[model samples]
Target: MASKVIHALYNDDDILMLAVKKVKAAKHHIEEVYCPFPVHGLDKAMGLAPTRIAITAFIYGCIGLAVATVMMNFIMIQDWPQDIGGKPSFSYLENMPAFVPIMFELTVFFAAHLMVITFYMRSKLWPFKQAENPDVRTTDDLFLMEIEIHDNEEELLALLADTGAVEINISEK
Candidate 1:
């Protein structure tokens, strides 16, 4: 069976934020909000759970740091050691300063790359994926809020209109 959804369009992000807070306070379930650009504090206004991507980035950085450490130790200390600028070549501890740049680069590289991949996976976004935003204008200049309909369509529409929505639509999907 198809489920009914109400799409309310807001011309401005500030208005959208206010509408989200109002809808949430009225106990309506908001499926999502789509906008041309990110709306600051909209997630909190919509009462969304906080994301943990930062923690994952930290873990990825640690992994990268470890890999760089081990790889540098083996290549410089065991595989092939060479003297440069009279620096000690026999001990990794002695040559630690020389490896600092590589370690920092690799740590940032892994964290950024892995974090992007993880975000893509979590969001189910990939190349050639079908667009899911209901309104094309949402990608241009509009903000859309999707609400599930229970039984009070009229009341919902009226409330959405009162919240400064420029356009409101309903569909079953």
Candidate 2:
């Protein structure tokens, strides 16, 4: 069976909320929602769970910090230790302040670079990947709600009209 989407375009959050409430009252299935910018309490309005991207970013940053610390300590203290300007080379505990800059740089480098790679991989985004965006305007200036209807097109249209949708379009995929 072909899937149908009844998408409504809204320019304001109030209208969006009213539409959402109407859809809920009528027991319609909403497939997706798109917005130009995040609206306050929007995930709650849509009943969505919080994303774990921040958690993933924190874990990746910690991994980077740990790697940098270990690598710097091993290179400077353990293998081929060199005495610079008569500074002590036996242990870094005394002059650990000198390694702060390098450590900070490595931490930022790993966090930024590795986090981006991980996010892209986890989101399945890669070079030349074409995303299936329903409407280009939805990405910039409009908020869209895609409602799925099995066979009740007339009933769905009535509901959308009652909710004050500015424009409506149907697409089959």
Candidate 3:
């Protein structure tokens, strides 16, 4: 099955932003926007919900800290109580200072790595997945806005033209 969509191309990010706002004001549903670089406040302008990646990062960091604490306690206090440098103490609390670096490193490592994997999976960017970029020029400098046509092609084209779209094309997807 093929669906018809309108592709409006813009040369500047500012123009694209304005176009998006105008289209939204006219109650036309925007499918997606492709840009060469991140546009500040684009997500808010598109009315997208806030991401929860930070929450996941916090959880992963806590798990890493707990694992580090348990591993260090088992190794230093229970498994092999070493009396190094004349410090004859098998207490985990007394040897906590030595484990601070390891704990910090593990926390950061888990947060960073898990966040990356979560991002990739959430974005549907598997290793074998094909790219869904609508226009190649969007990767260079142009910005492309895709809007599905719902029996309002002429009205949408006129609206897009008024919004300063440099070039517009209608295609099936």
Candidate 4:
């Protein structure tokens, strides 16, 4: 099934932001926006919910910490206890200082790596996946806003034109 959509092209980020706000105020649903660079506050203007990746990173870091602790304890304390530098390795608490660096490294490693994987999965961006952007110019110096039409094509066209869109195109998706 092909659905109709309006692609409004903007030459500047400021114009795009204003257009987004106006369209949102007029109660028109914007399907997506593509920009050559990141536009600050655009997410809020689009009424998107805040991302939860931070919480997931924290959880992954904790898991990494726990794994490192357990692995070190089992290796140094129970598996083959060795007295290096005259410090007995029979207890984990006494040998805790030596494991600080490993714990910190593992925590950061897990947090960063897992966060990227989580973000990719959540965004449905798999390996070799095709891009969904409608305009190639959006990857260069243009900003493209996509709005789905719902029986008000003329009204949307007029509104988009008034919002300072340089070029407006209608197509089926």
In terms of TM-score, the best-performing candidate is 4
* Candidate number with greatest lDDT: 4
lDDT per residue, candidate 4, 1-173, as tens digits? 89999999999999999999999999999999999999999999999999888899999999999999999999989998998999998699999999999999999999999999998889999999999889999999999999998999999999999999999999999
Worst 10-residue stretch by lDDT in candidate 3? 83-92
TM-score of 3: 0.95
Instruction: Please give the CA lDDT of all the candidate structures.
Output: 0.94, 0.82, 0.93, 0.95
Ranking by TM-score: 4, 1, 3, 2
Shift of residue 141 alpha carbon in model 2, Å: 2.4
Per-prediction TM-score: 0.96, 0.85, 0.95, 0.98
Task: List the lowest-lDDT window of 10 residues for candidate 1.
Answer: 81-90
Model 1, 87-171: lDDT tens digits are 8788889999889999999999999999999999999999999999899999999999999899999999999999999999999
What TM-score would candidate 4 get against the native?
Answer: 0.98
Per-model root-mean-square deviation over C-alphas: 1.1, 2.2, 1.2, 0.8
Off by over 4 Å in 1: none
Pairs in clash, predicted candidate 2: none
**What is the lDDT ranking, best to worst?**
4, 1, 3, 2
Candidate 2's residue-wise lDDT over 1-173, tens digit each? 79888988988877898788778778776888888887777676677788887777677778777887788778988886888888887886765888888777877787788778888898799999997778888888888999887889999998898888888999895
Candidate 2 structure lDDT? 0.82
Q: For residues 13-95, what per-residue lDDT tens digits would candidate 3 score against the true structure?
A: 99999999999999999999999999998888887889999899999999889989999899888998888877655688898
